[model samples]
Target: MNKKLVSMFLAGAVFLGTLTGCTQPANEGKQGGQEAVKVGMVTDVGGVNDQSFNQSAWEGLQKGEKDYGIRISYQESNQEADYAPNIEILVDQNTDLIWGVGFKMGKAIEEAAENYPDFKFGIIDYAYEKTPENVVGVVFKEEEASYLVGLIAGKMTQTNRVGFIGGMDVPVIQKFQYGFMAGVKKANPDAIVDVQYANAFNDPARGKAIARQMYQRGADIIFHAAGDTGTGMIEAAREEGKFAIGVDRDQNDLAPENVITSAMKRVDNAIYEVSKRLADGNFPGGTTIVYGLKEGGVDIAPTTSKNVPQEILDFVEAQKQEIIDGKFTVPSTEAELNAMK
Candidate 1:
């Protein structure tokens, strides 16, 4: 009836279609100019609240969320079997990066990396062979940190005897023991170090038992790298009024009066740094990232204002700087141990 009016109606319909396309859910503008890149972490068997490696890794994720506006989430594996599934969940979600929090998850991470070559991954404490082009292996100079702790233990022991309790009899644990013994020897050659391993990450009872045995054997101070197992060591120290050193995190607050210090691994920092890189599109892949004293990856906790002598605190601070400056190298390998002899 009216050709011009029909043409105008068609034009209006085209305009409405354009508006609908612009308003589509997938094309709608995001709240923050860009969608937040999600970061996911799969924790080791000790879980995220273990107050150790898992806790540190979670802290890094939190830091990334706060600093870079990232979306961070985590899944704690209660069993070794859950590792692969948890990693798969993250990868399926299109997470920008997936962090595998401990050496125990190395195999799972390797599998996930191979299956999802386009996704980025970061694994702590171990590296893999035939790794995809999108994985970063993060390890630490734990022996160097443990050596410093040994020096402290050696110097502070009134009985000239100390003890070390490790979570497992792995090479990583050996590094801690060797470094500690070397540090003790460097500081007080006459001092004795009693070393033991619990062989489990979650057994606090075994840790306490070992610490009690060491204490009965004239050990005045004990250092534990046993994850949750170390909690029992601190408890033993508190009950007996002996000294205990923590690992991975600042556990001084756990048993304030009994815990002299902790061998800090700065796992939190490593996680945050990697997550930040991923957010910035600078994801580190096909490379191993080793953080140590110089990178603030490891150190001793601050001496609290109680029980710690001012002179000892000063000495620790001085030695810390020396280690950072490379003036003092802490022994880590069999050859280094032999050189100390």
Candidate 2:
């Protein structure tokens, strides 16, 4: 007697199942449309607040959040081993972009990029040999910036001797050294340029020791490319009443009296610009971006609150424009330096 009703109920159940299945894709589409874009960063071995490269990259991510309304997060890698895992964490979180900060992370970023082709990645200061389609390499014309600093060091040195302390022996650091030496040679042909490598980013003691050695060797001003190591050099400069140039961020605030000026990297600017492009669906991949003086990617800091002589400050400002306007070209290679001479 109830067969007709039972058959009807079974048909109703089939209809409901079909409707649920059809609604699933639309619901997924709606969720995807409403999802917020997220960006994450993994710092290099120097960690996030090194007052150097890592710090600069993190500053860019912060700016991206503020300007683009994207969610941003970061992980500071205390050791080299942490690079891949930290990037994996961001990928697992479904981050739209993961920035691997510094040359130390090149291998990790390369490996991760291969494993996740759809995930976008960017690294600062270095590039991979075999990078994925979604990866962007962000490098800098560091030599260009360092060359300007070298000019300052050459002219401002009272002892006619200047020094450069690098964090590691990488090509990136060498670019800074070579550029600086070239600049000094151009400005003061008689000036002596001493160079050394700390080999580690976190050792302040080593930085101080190197700076002291350079100072004792008759160098009056030292330019440091070391991360925390540079802090030690700045400290030594302050104690000895000499001058030290800062790097990456505007480190004039660290020791306002001793830091003559910082060779600005504009890492924050790079991060912000990259994230903005990615968020706008104009992601720049498979191309390496090299930012320099004209793009405002690098420059020297303004005279600090300590009041460097107005005359010297004015001269530096004028020189900055000259470099940007193509009037003065900084050399990066030994060959270029010789050519400039």
Provide the global lDDT of candidate 1 against the true structure: 0.81
- In every candidate, how many clashes are there? 0, 0
lDDT of 2 by residue, 1-341 (tens): 34334435533543465211110010011123665578888877676778887788877877766665777777667677667656765665577898888888888888777878888999888866755688899888888879878878887888899999999988888888998998788668999999999999888889999999999999998998888888899989888888999888888877788898788899899989988898778998887888998887887776532435666666666877878888877777668777874
**Candidate 1 minimal-lDDT segment of 10 residues:** 19-28
RMSD in Å for all candidates = 11.7, 11.8
Off by over 4 Å in 1: 1-31, 129-131, 304-306
Off by over 4 Å in 2: 1-33, 128-131, 304-308
Task: Report the number of the highest-lDDT candidate.
Answer: 1
The 10-residue segment of model 2 with minimum total lDDT is 19-28
C-alpha displacement of 49 in model 1, angstroms? 0.9
lDDT of each: 0.81, 0.79
